[model samples]
Target: MWFKHLIFYRFTQPFTLTADELEEKLTAKCFKPCGSQDISTYGWVPPLGRHGDMLTHSAGDFIIITARKEEKILPASVIRDALDEKIETIEQEQNRKVASKEKKLLKDDILMTLLPRAFTRHQTISAYIDRQEGWLIVDASSHNKAEELTSCLRDSIGSLPVINPPVKNAPSHFMTQWLSPKAVLPVPFALGDECELREPGDEGGQIKASKQELTAEEITGHLDAGKQVSKLALSWDDALTFVLGDDLVIRKLKFTEVIQDQLDAINAETAAEQFDADFSVMTLTLRKLLTDLINALGGEIDEASRGEYIEKKILEVSKKQQTAEETAQETA
Candidate 1:
């Protein structure tokens, strides 16, 4: 999987360098000769640091070097002596290049800290460091001890600043794809386990029915009453009743169409009223009504004319209800 990775770092003081300039400086300073071998022959692995600043490296088994902006350079001799005393299989050339790269990398990339984790599992770490702009990116696959790794690196480097990469908000089980077949298999069930089982026609048994055999009549009662149905003017009571009943789905569709029509009518009226009166309020009302209609239909209404009509209808209904309540209170 391709991950969106970032490097983070902090500086004691601010320093400035363009991207190209920083890159060039790091390449020059970090790449050094090993004995008589040409520096070019040695591998000059580019430094990876957080926020692209703070070059870092495993100086030896016991030491880590973290260099930042304006920090004094640790002498090559000091590094050589430390490695010879502590680290085994010391390659003079490789050690020099590694140390040089650690310092130079810190000055190239700069960024802020976002996430930090204890290094407890990795044996080798990928270090990213940029100091000029202030960033450090570190990925150590070798160090598995988080506290030991972090503490060791911090202690040896004189602590200019250290940062960890951001914790990704990735889905759990993201590595499911990488799991081995054996690891992914389900556990075997033993015989005579207490799992639920049933015979045909057993008491409290699971019920099964075919969709083709299940008719609407079986679910809902027959509506054979010879009652006449008539189309009625739109009202809040009727609308609410439809919404809270089985007719809600069909009613919603019809209501949305009706609201659209109303919006069109309002727009036409507003255009005509532009010469006679202020239709601003009416326009606003219509817009609100259209919005409600769209909401009722679980859709979006973006047209201004439609929104105005919807708003007007909603306000009119609200005012009517308020007036009715006031009259009832007066009578009481």
Candidate 2:
């Protein structure tokens, strides 16, 4: 499936597991329907759903996986009304106010009572592992949801040595540079009519513009007043369009007509075949887009340097912990 957003992580160490090995590990956590009284469940699922039975779908060098989550839908208002009624009844009958701790226990009991009857909602997030690129790209709009899939994968595979890959330049800084008075964006990158600018400081003001020329006097005026671009929409080679954030998260990703034309050319006969074609073409296009985008943003931090940086940070933390322990001992 085409991902509408991307939150990618880079593997610190080499990803050596083959598709079959991964499928075996994932099978241990295959998705199952939530049980009565269960609030939520998370597990692996087939990438192609009913069209394909395999837990992992391999396209070229990339392997695709899906995580399914199911949660009961218990409204806060309903719970509040129920709790109020019960609390009022207990207080009236016992002639005393319910304590905070007692109220918490009552709420827990109420949840258990209502969970089995509550309607359920389901969502699935898909991700692809690029072994050669050492990237785990998730189709999630938020970092929290993306981490849910990675957390499940870590539990399945024992460990996942992945990090939010670092880049040489800050995304916001570089993006702001591109829109500066004398700057020019890299080849094939053209500005779209949307951006968010924020002033510098904790309490700084922010503004958003949509469907307006980014080079307009009003926008550059914000930059002149010491504001930075936090989010900017841009297109790549007429193939893909997306909004890049200061945090390097890609949002509102759209594969353009160029990509669609390629898919249309495939014209696969079966549903499974179409799905396969879409995944293959989309992944390939995305790979190219990532490559160019990274270069334009001054490239990714190489693995060796990233490893060294991580080691230094870990050592610093360890020293701080040791110092804290010594202080505690002295105080004791």
Candidate 3:
């Protein structure tokens, strides 16, 4: 119902599916509980809380989707204890020290047996499709996790015209300019009292200064002395506050007290109505702040070479998957 983080992607081409159409497509891969012997499962869930079977949640042109991934949480220590005890018992009975390969096989057997009875943990990530704006906003802090959502989506709908959206201005330069401001500050944005600065390179020189006014001499001195802003905290038009990273990941999100107070006034007679209202308000706030942020950063980049970049990123991810598979095969 409430989203805390975002990883955004732009639709490089037109996306013309309606909510009903989307639901029909996604229903093919709707969430299923993990089997007794299964390690993990990922699929779509109803974004409209406990009431609906449909996966897509719509607020005007925004079509929201939630992904639930459940995985068994078998601890390594538990397995280790069981394995050590078994090894000791075998040694006392009829065995010498177990070979390393034999020990590994025994551990694997134990894990497979324990998995059926192991406790499971589930996490749901909410995402919204801004069809009108040609962007998909996923509630994820990691690029890999966000891309997992994208992969699930592509599997569901057959195709998606998405790529990691690029901002025209480099984040470091943009933040430095905003902090010192030789020119006027970007409209609809204000600096907050938290920042992390780093000297650029592999040497790993950095400073984290927070709760002090960013404009003050103490803070400005770091910038003047030879540090570039790697991550800076910002307040967005009193609706949301977050730390913006140089890679454009938004973290540490807290809705401003002002927006919450306004939201509190919109009481609904029914639970469903309340749920709808909450999502609508949240989605609108994100849309406004992100749209403005994108605009201020010279809007989304539309270069001829962007297609090549997207293909390269996809290839990198593909290579990672291939490498992982090869490693697993070798290990096997």
Question: What digit string (tens of lDDT, one per residue) describes model 2 on residues 290-329?
Answer: 8888899998777578778667645764696699789999
Q: What TM-score would each prediction reach against the true structure?
A: 0.18, 0.91, 0.90
* Candidate that scores best on lDDT: 2
- Residue 162 deviation, candidate 3, in Å? 1.7
**lDDT, model 3:** 0.84
Q: State the lDDT of candidate 3 residue by residue for 151-203, as single tens digits.
A: 89999999877867667678888888787845465887888888998987879
The per-model lDDT (C-alpha) reads: 0.29, 0.89, 0.84
User: Which stretches of model 1 miss by more than 4 angstroms?
Assistant: 1-15, 30-43, 46-135, 142-332
lDDT of 1: 0.29
Q: Write the per-residue lDDT of candidate 1 for residues 1-332, one digit (tens) a residue.
A: 00011122333233333434434444434423332211112212333333223332321111112222111223456555544443333345356334645533432221011001111111223333344334333332222322233444444333433322112221112112111122221111011101111122325332222222212232111111211111111222121111111111112212234434444555445433331122232223323433343233334333454446455645764696699789999754
Q: After superposition, how far is residue 141 of candidate 3 from its true place, in Å?
A: 2.0
The TM-score that candidate 3 achieves is 0.90
Against the true structure, candidate 2 reaches a TM-score of 0.91
